[model samples]
Target: MAVTLADYEKVVGPEVMDEIRTLAGYVRHKSLQNINSTPVGGGVAEILTRMIPLLRELGVDATWDVIKGNEAFYAVTKAFHNALHGHPETITPKMLEVFRENTAMNLEEMKLEGDVLFIHDPQPAGLIDKKPTIGRQWIWRCHIDVSNPDPAVWEFLRPWVERYDAAVFSMPDFAREMPIPQFRIAPSIDPLSDKNRDLEPEVVRGVLERFGIDPERPVLTQISRFDRLKDPLGVIESYRMVRRHCDCQLVLAGGGADDDPEGAEVLREVEEAAAKDPDIHVLLLPPFSDLEINALVRGSTIVFQKSIREGFGLTVSEGLWKGKPVIGGAVGGIRLQIINGVTGFLIHSPEGAANRAVELLSNPELCRKLGENGQRYVRENFLITRHVKDYLLLMLALDHPGERVVRLAGI
Candidate 1:
């Protein structure tokens, strides 16, 4: 079910909705072109899928486009992704060549019709090379943590990044010393979306039964891609440590991205890690398994996001939105989502996660309190209504770059 502008007004008040309408009125027909690598399987695509329609309903012409690149393009971009997230990876000259070749091809094929082009991540960053001729306000929205980026990959992508009118990052620390002004726009979740909506008790029960999840024992879930950086194996180790103390089940389920060639390999690694544990359930769901994901989170006793590296852990926000206290890694955007002991515990190692999980499991009152606080926190700060307002303000600011002084004589 697509969220409409009225749905937003219902969550937030009509006054804020009116303000959005007023801001959007300034750029009623100004097109917003969002270009990313894939239209499914990742947070970037998931966010834009929900955001674009709401923007249009607010009177801005918003459209999403995907950049078409072959396997080589994705392979190079995947390595670039690791490098940007502070992972040590060698970017060969051939990889650079692949990046440029894919960019050149996408530049020729993608339509540059929108007045403002928002290129998402390194996958479509080089699309700005055509901005010189396309003549539009281009903004690069960097969703990864570039705090400790690999110098070579940064050098390659930074030139294209500097060409943008502005840049948007998820966290303040993720921002680098770029010449262009940067804005801190945190990612948000939609409470009313299929992935976070209120579900019937029977629905949750049925989903659990279908997956053979024993509700009698506590279920610990880590919902994310089966990628190495997500640390599914580490999550299993943590769960195993916790299992020694309590009877619990572990669910490691996620889908693959078209741009990520290494997902299947990582999935196999996780499978091998859990081969001996009959209590471990590994599911390779389709990219848009919103209702199923929601049910899994609802059925779990606790949710975990043990990522070694993360752009922003949207799954953390999703779990928190469901009032499930998430145990996330103390890295990247997970720090912003899990507020230590308030929303959930942020840990550095498997031992730390196991310790926290054991503590939470023993104290039901503390778990309930943290979960309640987390739900409210996410509702107020991380909902899509707030995200829409921020983007609308950015659009207004970009439209009137020199309108600092509004004349009040008429008023």
Candidate 2:
């Protein structure tokens, strides 16, 4: 069943729904086309999946498209992804050629026609070259933390980025010294999505049993792709440390995105680290396993996002939205989501994560309080409705560049 705006009103209230509709009305004349690397997997795709439908329901003409790329192309982009996250990756001229060639292929095949051409991440950013012919408002949405990106990669991408009408980043710190207008809009989670929805107790129990996780034993879960940056190995180390003091199980569950080529290698490393630990469940769930993920988080006593580097870490919000206390790394957008000691604990190492996990597991009351705080925080700030409103405002702001106040007509 398709989720309607009316369904969201029960969670976000009627006034928020009214505001979204009003904003949509202002931009009804324009059409939006969101282009990203993949249609499934990462936060960018997941967000667009839910957001596009809502935008259309609100009377805005919105469409989404994915750029085509082969394995070689994705491998280069994956390297670029790592480099952008401040990882050390060697970028050769051949790698740059692979990126350009694939982007050229996408440009030749795709029709660049929309009032607003929203290009996401570096994968499809080269499509902006078509802006001269299309003459549309091109917005580059960078979802990675490029605060200290590899100088070579940043230099290569800078020219293309500066050509945009505006750039949107997940954090203010991620913004660079670009000439174009920059907006800081954090990513959000769909409260009613299968991954974050309210699942029945039976469903949660069944999922736990199917995965061989003991329902009675407290489970620590980190739901993210098997990417090195997500630090699945570190999560296992944390789980091992927690085992010494607390008797609990661990669940490391996620799948791959089409654009990511490194998932298989990372999965192998995770499996090796998990190595014969009956208590450790390393699940490589296929795509569209949101319900199982929801159950895993709900069944777990504590959720971990323990990312070494991240873009915004939507799983952190998903776990928090499910009212599970999240312990995440002190990096990237994770810093924005985990409010240190308030909503959740921000750890710097596996030991820190393990210590925090033990603390939460020992005292259920503190866990409850943190979970309550996190749920409220996500409800007020990180829901999909707030995300749409920000985009609507950004669209409106585009019409009146450099104006302090955007005066919409008839209001």
Candidate 3:
């Protein structure tokens, strides 16, 4: 979707887009290469799908590259991901050997000749080992929440992480005490994209109908991959609790990412848990189902993100932007997005989530109030325009480290 900066004026105001253009001048004509593991599965790919085109529109020669890996490679990376979220997992010597082998293969194949190379996530983190040979500015963008990461995993990744000239994290607390400068650039949503943009009433109704859902009744939905960290089974339990208090339907929608092998297993677990419940709708949406997802959030009474350990929780922002109160876990970026009863309530368990859902379903006026607050909060803080502006600033900081001030007109 060609979402130009000019197309965002109605949602973000012309002044904001104008300021972004002014900032873009500083990094104009510079080549930036972004590398990650997947092309269409997770949030990193989703963000780059929109970002690279916008960066090019602002005169930067921006390109995105995806690393190649087999099922074994992805399985090892998935384990490392779970451990990074503080889950206890055995990191064996064989796993480290596989990770190193894959990283070396990618480094040899990837053409790293950009003025600024932005390596994202741990999958390609070991690419930093070639920094001295390439001799260019490298910024590592970590989109995971490593607040209490497994020490062994962190120590394993630390040497490669420290090799970057700078690092980018979704939250400040996710940063470690590395020697390089760390930038906190929260992931953002494209308001004009197919996922967050407005849909016709018929389109919304069609989506609900396609899923055999009733629009007149209260609907609770959570959109994320069928992963353990997302706590889909926990969401089902919470839905049951709320069902006892009120007659509402629950929709657990999302498919497995291409790089995550545990998705089918997790989906089976959720299906088994939701068996015999006619009101619970378990949808296995395929990739590029943004319009359906948009309709799901837009047509719902409320949204739930109940993650055990979250990175940035961009879905919360998407739901809030669509004017729905989101009940999320009190963790990671959820804390930044939900203001605990102001924008939305933060819950620690399924009981707390069910209680909050009861309160919201019972009070339409309060739900509207919180939804309005959340929409405005996301517009002010979490939209793609602001995220692009932050990246522009980070580019400046990387280019000139010691300067007290940066002029957007000068590189």
Candidate 4:
């Protein structure tokens, strides 16, 4: 069932509905074009899938565009992703040429239109080179932890980034000390999406059975792409640590994106790590397995996101939105989602994560309290409604530069 804006009022409160109506009214006819690397797998695509329609339904002319890139392009972009996240990497001149060539191909082929163009992440950041000709307000929405980016890669990408009218970072810490205006807008999760919606008990059971997960034991699950940064191996290690005390089953399930070339390699490593533990189930979900992901999260005794570095942990938000107590790494946007002992626990080490997971699994009341608090946290802040409203307000601010207060809608 498609979730209408009215669903948000019931979940979040009518304040969100009134805000949406008012903010949307100002930008009802304004066109928005969202360009990103893939139309599947990652959070950017997932958010856009739900967000574009909701924006259109609310009277904004929002459109989504996926930038086409070949395997070589994705390979280079993967390296860029690593470097942006402060990982040590080597980007040769050849890789630079390939990235530039691919960007040129896209620029020539893709239609550049809309009053506002939102280029998501580093993959499609170069689209702004055409801004002079496209004559639209280009906003660079970077969903990566570029707090300490590799100098070489940053230098290469910085010039292109400077071309944008404004930039958005998931957390204030993720922002680079550049001249452009930066906004700290955290990413959100849709409560009504297939990945976070309410599920029937039988549906959850069937999914668990199909994946060979035994619901008889406590289930610890982590839903994320098979990325090294997500620390799938570390999650396995943490689960092993917790398993020493609790007889719980661990399930690692996530889909790979077209832009992430290292997914298969990481999956193999994760598979090998779980080889000796029959209790550990490794499920490689295909791109469109939102409901399956939702079921796994819903059925989990404890949900975790042990990312080494993250832009903003949307999966954590998704779990929190589902009223599940989450244990996320104390980094990036995960910190913003978990209020430490209130909503969920955020830890720095695998041992800390395991200890907390065991603690949460043992105490049902604490778990319920954490989950309830998390849901309310998501309701008040991280939802597509708030994201859209922020964009609308930003658009008005951009359109009228000197206006201190752009009344988005007349109450």
What TM-score does candidate 4 get on C-alpha atoms? Answer: 0.90
Per-residue lDDT tens digits for candidate 4, residues 1-411, read 777888877877787788778877887777998999998766788889888888888888999999999999998998998898888898999999999999999999999888899999998889998987868888999988899999888899999999898899888898888887888787887888787878999999998988988877889999988998899999998998998888899999988666456898999999999998899999988767889999998889889999887777788888888888999998878889999999999999999999999898889899999999998898878988788788887776677765666553354
What TM-score number comes out for model 2? Answer: 0.91
**lDDT, model 1, position 118:** 86
What's the TM-score of every candidate structure?
Answer: 0.89, 0.91, 0.92, 0.90
RMSD in Å for candidate 3, one decimal? Answer: 2.4
**Relative to the unseen true structure, what is the Cα RMSD of model 1?**
2.9
lDDT of each: 0.87, 0.91, 0.90, 0.87
Model 3 TM-score relative to the real fold = 0.92
- Encode model 1's per-residue lDDT on 312-356: one tens digit a residue: 788998999888889999988899889999999999999999999
User: For residues 1-411, could you state the per-residue lDDT of candidate 3 as single tens digits?
Assistant: 467877887899988888788878887757889999998867888889888888888887889988889888998998999899888999999999999999989888888878888999999999888888988889999998888999989999999999899999989889889898888888899898899999999999999988999998999999988998899999999999998889999999986666556888899899999889988999999878999999999999999999988878899999999989999999889999999999999999999999999999999999999999999999999998898888887776887886777554443
Q: Candidate 1, clashing residue pairs?
A: none
RMSD of each: 2.9, 2.5, 2.4, 2.7
Clash totals for all models, in order? Answer: 0, 0, 0, 0
What is the descending lDDT order?
Answer: 2, 3, 4, 1
Summarize candidate 2's per-residue lDDT along 1-411 as a digit string, tens digits. Answer: 999999999999999989988888888899999999998877788889999999999888999999999999998998998898888999999999999899889989998778999999999999989988878898999988899999999999999999999999989989999899999998899999998899999999999999999999999999988988889999999999999999999999988766456888898888998888988999989877889999999999999999987777888999899888999999878888899888899999999999999999999999999999999999988999999999998888888888887666763
TM-score preference between candidates 1 and 2, better one? 2
